[model samples]
Target chain A: MRHLLTTQGLPRDEAIAILDVAEDMAAVGEREVKKLPTLRGKTVINLFFEDSTRTRISFEAAAKRLSADVINFAAKGSSVSKGENLKDTAQTLAAMGADAVVVRHWASGAPKTLADSGWIDAGIVNAGDGTHEHPTQALLDAFTIRRRLHGSASRGRDLDGVSVTIVGDIVHSRVARSNVWLLTTLGAKVTLVAPATLLPVNLSGWPVDVSFDLDHAIAQGPDVIMMLRVQGERMAAAFFPNAREYSKQWGLNDERMRALPASSMVMHPGPMNRGLEISAAAADSPQSTVLDQVRNGVSVRMSVLYHLLSGAVER
Target chain B: MSVRTVLQHADITRALTRISHEILESNRGSDDLVILGIPTRGVTLANRISAIIESVDSAVIPAGALDVTMYRDDLAQNPTRPTRPTDIPHGGIDGKTVVLVDDVLYSGRTIRAALDALGDLGRPRAVRLAVLVDRGHREFPIRADFVGKNLPSSMEERINVRLEEIDGVDEVTIG
Candidate 1:
C-alpha cells in the first residue's frame, strides 16, 4: 500500500480492496458535487518525465476530485532540459512538501527510484514507467471489466475465472504487461495474441497462453477481448512487414469483431489506431470499453492516491 | 474492563418498535419518508426499523445506506478506513424526509460527515437523526431526534452495539 509501482506482486485481497474503493470513487464522480474532502489540504504533484496527456490528465482529475492541491511538473521544458536529474527534481518537490507524487517516466524503474531514494517523503505512484508497468491503467481496465461483467455488485470481487484474450503489440505494451500480471493475479485465464515479431522474446515465465492467430483466439469467444495499440514509434526496427499486413494478420477488423460473442467486451487503452490496430466499427462498437477505461482511469487513480496517501505510509 | 449489557435483544426490539411508531407519528404515516443508515450496523438497524414501520403502518418506506468515509474529517488521525457503499433509494432523497439512522451517536463527527455526503447526492426536504443508542459525548452541537436509549457514559468507555444481521447477536454493551 506504500506505493503502487506495479500490479505484479499485489495481493488478491488488496487488488479487490482497490477495486472496491474505486467503486466508491466512481460513486463520488456521479454526485452533484463530484468532489470529496478526503485528501483536503494535501498536495499531489503530477511529475511527468514523458509526454502523456491522457494519463497526466487522469491523475490530475483524480487528485482534483479528491480536493488535493495539484502541481503539474512536466519534464520536457523545465529545469530537466537544463540537466536537472531526477534526484535533484525530487529534492525540489520534497522541499515543496508534496504529500504524494504521481510520476510517469520513460525509464522502467523511475517511480521505484523516486520511492526508494531518500530525496522525497511523498507517496510515489507509478503513473507509468516505460514498458515496465502502468498499474493504474491495468487497474482501470480491470475495474471496467468487472463493472461490465458484474454491474452494481462488483464490489470486493476479483475477475475470477473470466477469460481474456489480449491482442496486438505485446512487446511494447506496458498496458499488456500490466494486464498480464494483474489479470492473472485476479484469476482470469489470459491468452496473449500477437505476431511473433511484436511479442517479447520470453513468455515462458509469464502466466498466459501465447497464440499468434487473432481469428483463432476470437473463435474461442472469450469474455474480454482487449486490443492493444500498435506502438508505431517503437516499430522503427521493422517489427512487422507493414501496417496493412499487420492489420490483415492481427488487427481487430469488422469480420474479426463479428466473430466474437455478443457478451464479449472489446477494450482498448486509447488513443486507438482506428484502422491499424482496430477498425472504426470495432472501436465504436457497443462492445467497446475504450471510453469506460478512460472514465475509470480517474476513479482508479483516485483509489490509488487514497490508498497511498490516506495512511501516509513511511518511505 | 467491566462490560455491562445496556440493552438485550428483546429490549432492542421494543425500543426499535417504539422508534418506528414515533417516526410514523412524526412523519404522518410515511409519505415521502426515506430512511438512510450510516453504514455498518446502522444499515441493519435501518432495515429493522423500516420493516417494523412497514408491518405496523402497512406502507413501504424506502431504506438505504449512506457511507460518509470520503466526507470525514478524521483522515489525519485514522486514514486507512475502507469506504462502505452508499446506496440511496430508487426514488432518491430529494424533497423527502430523511431519517439518518446509526447504532451509536458519539462525537457527532460521523453525522456531520453524513450530512456533507447527503448534500452532494441530493437535497432532502428535511433531515433528522435517529440512533439505537445515544452515548452522549457530543463534540459537535448535534443531537439525535429519536433515540433508542440515552445511556450517559464517560469518554473513556467504549460502546458496542451488536446486531444479528452482522454480528450474530442483538445487544448493546458498554465497557
Candidate 2:
C-alpha cells in the first residue's frame, strides 16, 4: 500500500478498492469547484527520469486538486542530467518532506528500487517504468471501463464477466502488461492480439490468451477492444515491415471498427497513432473510451495518492 | 451476547416526520435550503427528509451526499475503505442553508469532517447537523440542530442504526 510499483501481483480487493475510490474522486471532479483539502499540508513530487508530459501533468493536476504542493522534477534539467542518480535526487526530495513521489523512469524497476531501497521515506507511485507496468494507466482504464459498464452505480463492482482484447505493440507496452495483470485480477478475461514480431517471447504462465490475428480476436466479441500505441520512437529495428502493413494487419481500421459489436468499447492510452494503430474514425467513434480514460487518469492517480498518504490501509 | 432494539420501524418514521416538521418550522418554508447527507445511512435519511419536506410544502428541496472519508481525522487509526461519492446538488451550495444529516452523532468527529468537506464546495449560508441518534460521548464541541432521539449511551456501548434503504431494515440497536 505504501508504494504502487506494479500491478503484477496486486490483490483483487486492493485493485477494486483503488477503482472504487477513483469513482469518488471522479464524482468530486463533477463539482463546480473541483478541489479538496485532503492533502493540505502534504507535498507530492513528480520525479520523472524520462520525459512524459502527459503523465507528469496528470499527476501534477491530481496533486494540485487535492490541495497538495507539487514539485515537478524533470530529469533533463535537474541534477539527474548532471549524472546524479535516483538515490541522491530522492534523498534530497525526502529531506524537503515530500509526502509522495510519482516517478516515471526509463529503467523498468526504478520505482520499485526507490521504494524498497529505503533511500526516501515518501510513498512511491509508479507513473510509468520501462515496459514493466503503468499501474495508474491500467487503473484508469479499469475505472473508465467500470464507469461505462455500470455508470454511476459502479462502486463495489468488479469486471467479473467482461472480456477485453488488447491489440498492438505488446512487446514494449507497459500499459498492455499492466492491463493484462490488473484486468485479470479484477476478473476480466484478457486476450492479447498482436503481430508475431510485436509480441513478447515468453508468454508462458501469463493469465491471458495470445492471438497473432486481430480479425480473429474481434470475431470473438470482446466487451473491450484496447488498442495500444505503436511506439515509433521505441522501434530501433522495424518490428513490422512498414506502417501501412502494420496498420493493415493489426490496426483497428474502419472495416475492423465496423465489425466490432456496438456494446464493445474502444480504448487507447493515448497520444494515439491515429491512422497507424487505430483509425481516426474509430478513435472518434462513440464506442471509444480513449478520452474517458484520459479524464479518469487524474481521478485514479488521486485515489492512489490518497490511499498512499491518507493514513489508511485497506478496508 | 445479543443486541436490544432501542427504536423500531414505526418509531424511526415518526421521528423523521417530527424532524421534518421541526426543519420546516425553523427554515420558514425551504427557500434556498439544501439537505446534504453524510454518506452510508445519512444520504438515505436526507432523501427521506427531502421527500417529506416536498410532500408537506410542495417545495422540491435539493438533496445531496457529502462523503467525509478523505477529511477524516482518525484515518490513521481506521482501515482504509473505498470512498463513497459526494454529490452536491445542482446550482451549488453557495448562500444556501445546508443541513447535514447522519445516522448517529457520536464523537462529532464525522460532523467536523463533514464541515471541512463542505468548506471546499463553495460557502454555504449556514450549515447545521441532524442525527437519528445522539449518543453523548462527544470528543468535539459539536451539536446537532435536529435530533430524532437523544439516547444517551456509555462509551463501551455501540449504536447501530439500520435503515430500510441501506440495510433492508429500519431500527436502532445498541450492543
> Model 2: per-residue lDDT, tens digit, B19-127?
9989988988889899999989999999999999999999999999999988888767766656888888888899999999999999899999999888888899998
lDDT of 1 at A131: 82
DockQ of each: 0.64, 0.63
lDDT of 1 at B144: 92
- lDDT (0-100) at residue A47 of candidate 2? 91
TM-score result, candidate 2: 0.94
DockQ category of candidate 2: medium
Question: lDDT per residue, candidate 2, A1-315, as tens digits?
Answer: 788999999999898889888888887888777988878888999998888988989999999988899998889977888899788998999999988999999899999999988899888999889989999999999999999999978888999989999999999999999999999989999999998888999999789999888899999999999999999778899888999999999999999998999999999999898899999999999999988988999999999988898765442
How many Å off is the CA of A247 in candidate 2? Answer: 1.7
Best by lDDT: 1
- The segments of candidate 1 whose C-alpha lies over 4 angstroms from its true place after superposition are none
Residue B77 displacement (Å), model 1: 1.8
